[model samples]
Target: MILPCTSAAQDGWLRLRQALWPDCPEAEHLAEMAGFLREPDKYAQFVAYDEDGQAAGFAEAALRTDYVNGTETSPVAFLEGIYVAPQQRRQGWGRALVDAVTAWARTRGCRELASDALLDNVASHLMHRALGFEETERVVFFRKELS
Candidate 1:
């Protein structure tokens, strides 16, 4: 089962995020995740539970008013993070989590959903493809510190 991540769910979410992140094959930003969960408008993270009532996976999504990957205007839905346990993969848990998020987005009239993975994350890329995601564009980000 999948459910919204609330204050009560924070600890588990954080733990799962840190655990799966090694294989996440994407960006790592814990402070940002904390802020997003604490701040109302920043994000909506969710967690999935297994038959034993143990947390199995998580997904972090948000309403990005800024430009999304493929849209003209703000993104109706943006997937910041998603992770399923290696043992739990190939089951319907991840897809159920995605469905939950999309359902949440559609309620607000969201048209599209966007997510990104590192260039070399074959598993993630395959998952996206299985979910019917198409590659729109790929741009590498560069950051500089000027103080």
Candidate 2:
């Protein structure tokens, strides 16, 4: 089953988020999760659970009024992250999570959904395609720091 992330206290959501972004500290994750939870109009997250009631995957999305690389809409729904436990992959969890995000975006009047993956993450690219996302453009961002 797929459920909306209504609380930052949901352990399953925290665990799956940590799995997807292991390098982030637990405190940082909690802080960000709290921030997201506070902004229901701008952010949405969903967690997928197996029949055994264990977290199998999760997806996070944000409504961005700022320019999103491939979308023409002003407030595009941008998928921030998604992950399915290795053992639970290919079991429809990812698709269900995206479906939840899609429904949430529509309610907010978003006309398009956009997402990105590292240039080398072929698996994510394929998954996006399978979920009905069309490739719009490829971009390489550059940054410089002045000391």
Query: Against the true structure, whose TM-score is highest?
Result: 2
- Across residues 21-48, which tens digit of lDDT does each residue of candidate 2 receive? 9999999999999999999999999988
Which regions in candidate 1 have their CA more than 4 angstroms from the true location? 8-11, 21-34, 37-42
lDDT (Cα, tens digit) per residue for candidate 1, span 1-147 = 887877633546877787766554324445656577686555677889898888889888888888887775555688878888778889977788888888877775678888888999998888888887787888899999999
- The candidate 1 region of ten consecutive residues with least summed lDDT is 22-31
* Model 1 residue 31 CA deviation in Å: 6.3
Candidate 2: Cα lDDT at 132: 99
Q: Model 2 misses residue 126 by how many Å? A: 0.7
Q: Pick the candidate with the highest lDDT.
A: 2
lDDT of 1 at 136: 81
